[model samples]
Target: MTNNQPAPDGVLRLINGYWATGVIGAASAHSLFTHLENGADTAAKLAARAEISERGTQTLLDGLVGVGLVQLHEGRYRNGPEASAYLVEGKPASLTSFAQLKLKHMGGLVALPDVVRAGGPVTDPTTEVADNPHWEEVVPAIAAQSVPAATLAAEVLGLAGAGPISILDVGGGSGIYSAVWLEANPQARATQLDWAPINAIARRLLVERGVADRFTSVDGDFHTTDFGTAQYDVALYSHIAHQEGPENNIAVLARLRQALRPGGALVICDYVVDDDRGGPAFPLIFAAEMLLKSKQGGTWRRCDYHDWLLKAGFEDVSFHSAPPATLVVAR
Candidate 1:
């Protein structure tokens, strides 16, 4: 053995200890960080509340403290600043919904090993999430979860042009994209389409946001439903394409094209891989998860959207960079 620890990559090879994800997952699952949502507690109290053995909880908390997700002081543990903001439930800027999404998908880590051996699409354990009644019930929370991203999309739509606009939001879970845009531009209205659970949530969210009067909800599967043709001034596809794959995306674009009035616009938001096939890290990692969970989805290239848009009968596609993903605007 040539002392592999110090192998050619030097510090780079040693620094990539693989247990980071597991440690974080363990911390989250145990609610070690979020349990401190109300206040700090001793390990004994936390373990009791979480219904785990105290010794195990203490050990896990120690690891979190080392990893900076938690802080240990005197004889108690608390969420660190970063965790407090994003991990705690009911916080103003909570990302716990996305974190839960991550946790729900963490089974992919183990599933990936089998996926590599089989060499094709892996069976998604989460496919049924779309069918769950709870999915409809939680759509508002999910839509609310998308507020930060939608706020940006709303700004883009505001800058595009002037009119009393009608927007069609396809696969509009949580209706964040439309809701945010409507909030920013009071003259704009939206038609939101998705599974019923999500539509239910979108209904309430639009009401709460004061746009329900202008909002219309269509609840059904996207594949068979009619998304009104030659009707709207703008259509939005946000984070929906990568879940279905290229062929479906092309078909969707074509359908939406028919839905747009002459010279109307289509806006797509998705992670774009560099044409050179290098790293953005987020899209690549997400592509791996798509392999494990989706049938036709992956992070695609920038050209893919442009080409697909053109092939689907759109012209003058424009691309803009948003962190971790790109916005594609076409007419």
Candidate 2:
């Protein structure tokens, strides 16, 4: 008896949606990826290593397998290739911060119903926190895992043939850029400026990466910092710029220009909106998250970045290949 009935859209969504969270949560709670850091193991072995009941662990492993996070061979379970690289703890690409940030902000998910009704975000993210206390812990975790983006941006800078580079990473978080660039080019140096909390993390990261000798960590409020006078060969406004209005962004770039040496470069990275201001989904989604959490929300558009850079006395501004965020570099 074949039931030839199409399920209602809402019903289908209700049944299948949110399933991904269960899989991720299971992995996080059990530290399964950390356990599997070295290699594959049977359900019993993994459960023993992770200190969970074998039956319970097997259930979660099966779920991960179903979600393509793990592979099942006989009774053994192992990380899938993607999971092994990014999800495994101790890996450079570990997504711990990504997962933790999602978990920390999961409460925003509750607004989905209202957002669906209103066709926009319901959260008011503009309320600023007086102090970012957890930044010390969070910054390091995020910076260590940011190699992919950093490497890509650095490559673009290299290809641009920019010379005598000195970068200022505002809200630089973990100083990954300094660590990576200094290692890549001995002639290059970087200043990682952020809040005191984040600088703590950045300092450790720089030291661990063996670049502390060259890299400088500046601690101050970016909104008020006097980023020096034409001292830098490059200025990097990464994930931090999108949090403010256009005026503020232009001001930051203007200040960056004042800080740049002659022919110095400026690089901007953020979730860019298309010129049409429609689609590409994620950046807009990020805007919504910013609305819900931060006071100022994220914004987009390649032209927007170029316009800001130009207004700031920059010429030959261009964008680099990047994720949802546009990477704008100028000199």
Candidate 3:
């Protein structure tokens, strides 16, 4: 143990990463966290509660313990702090639906080889936007996932002081960004442009948050929508840029810039890679996910964004570090 040596830990973890993802998905699918929270500490009890065989329950519980999602004390199992907080059903920040969505994506990853061989996505990513039955679950799940980052983005953008702002949320999925800002700035109003299905969910979310009066939904594809000129004080593209190629992104940014008022801000919140397009592991790995999913979308570098924003007529561009992604703010 004292002797220093290179380890193959990284390689092994990479190879077996799917195992962890599968385990988490399975547990979330079965509401294991909820069962644990309800005091099903023994495998036999958990199995009874979950309607699964005792043997299978024990096996899954052991795997959860191994992954630190569950804790073992004596002969009892319990939800770990992370699981208790974010995986338990009915929790405000629960990510169970998000985990389920990931499970669906994991199933699609089997076609990655075909995508690579064909040099394109095997399935149309646009279909998800056109007729996604999962929107009811997905919108809320994504909003839950984005809450912290949205809060931070609002703070960083000084939404509180922006004063009677008119905002446009381009391709806003859950409308979480606008919702957060509106809550922070009572006088701020937002217009969310997205697909009809997603707009339905955004409407529900805004109504539920009791901010529907301050927000309006424009149901259409962002690529074709005429974002009316020079009216909005701020335009936001949260987690949308990675879904387009350079030319398309530039076009979209230019449209957004046109939508903003003179001296207005354009906020791009996405997973931005380094200039070399390597490292900062999330965006790099996310690029592979994009390859497997989108026809022409992947993470972009900060330089790429800077060039695009400048070309779109945005000045005084800056990048800020945000959890799970980077935030590029321009005016």
Candidate 4:
């Protein structure tokens, strides 16, 4: 042991990383952020309103402040800017459900070693687990998580005021992209293809967003469902490429290409690693999650997407940074 250098600060933070997730999730479940937003600033008041123990409330508040999700001022605690926006229960952009849903995934991660040993999950989540299906929860939660990526893709593609364009969102979990785009461009309409149950959820959410009248749901698996030819001005395959093997993605991309209008674009959003497979921490780490959850699922390189999209009959492919995700546009 050297006197000058003693502790492994970064390593320790990584080791105890679940603390951050646990505390934040617990706070969200307790409605702590919503309570703070509603002006229950003091520990006692928050505890009373949230039905938490006073000491428990104080400790949780302190943890939230430590994690930068809450701010402390003059012995009072309140939500930080992000918590104020996305952790509150009733907001459209709220990730409260997502946070709670991730708490369910944490326990499953304990089997990562077993999953790796077996070369994948003993039973893959991608295969549709009837005993413990997560996609129902996963779809909606993912919509909140995808707000930034979806919104960014819309802007990058000039969806706003792109008059009367039709969108085909294959595997469009919560139909968030459609909702976001339709809201931005009134003349736009969307068709979402997903499982019957998932499409129902998307339909309900779209109804809540007041855009269901212009949205259509096609209830079936994207792999088997017919995407139709040259029907859509824009085709979206977001956050799904990572869940598939190269061949599967390529096949789907080819179908997406055929579905687009003559001069239309196909937009793909995913966690794409650089060709060299170097760094960009989150996507690389996310590969491990995919590894444990599905067979043949992992983060792919830029070259992989380029090759796959081109092989799928797309002439030009370009990548764009959308923060925490990347977008590939093919035309």
TM-score of each: 0.76, 0.85, 0.88, 0.94
Which residue runs of candidate 3 sit more than 4 Å off their true CA positions? Answer: 1-10, 35-52, 73-78, 123-129, 132-137
Better of 1 and 4 by TM-score: 4
The C-alpha stretches of model 2 lying farther than 4 A from their native spots are 1-18, 73-75, 111-130, 159-164
Pick the winner on TM-score between candidates 2 and 3. 3
What is the TM-score (0 to 1) of candidate 1?
0.76
Give model 4's clash tally: 0
lDDT of each: 0.74, 0.74, 0.86, 0.87
Query: Which digits, one per residue and each the tens of the lDDT, describe model 3 over residues 28-134?
Result: 88888999999999998989999988898888888889888999999989999999988998875688878877767777778888998987887666655658787
- Which pairs clash in model 3? none
Top of the candidates by TM-score:
4
Give the local distance difference test score of model 3.
0.86
Error of 4 at 278 (Å): 2.3
lDDT for 328 (candidate 1): 83
Q: Measure candidate 2: CA RMSD.
A: 3.6
Worst 10 residues of 3 by lDDT: 122-131
lDDT of 1 by residue, 56-119 (tens): 8878777678668787778777888988876676664565555444545555477777776665
CA lDDT of 304 in candidate 3?
A: 96
How much lDDT does candidate 2 score? 0.74
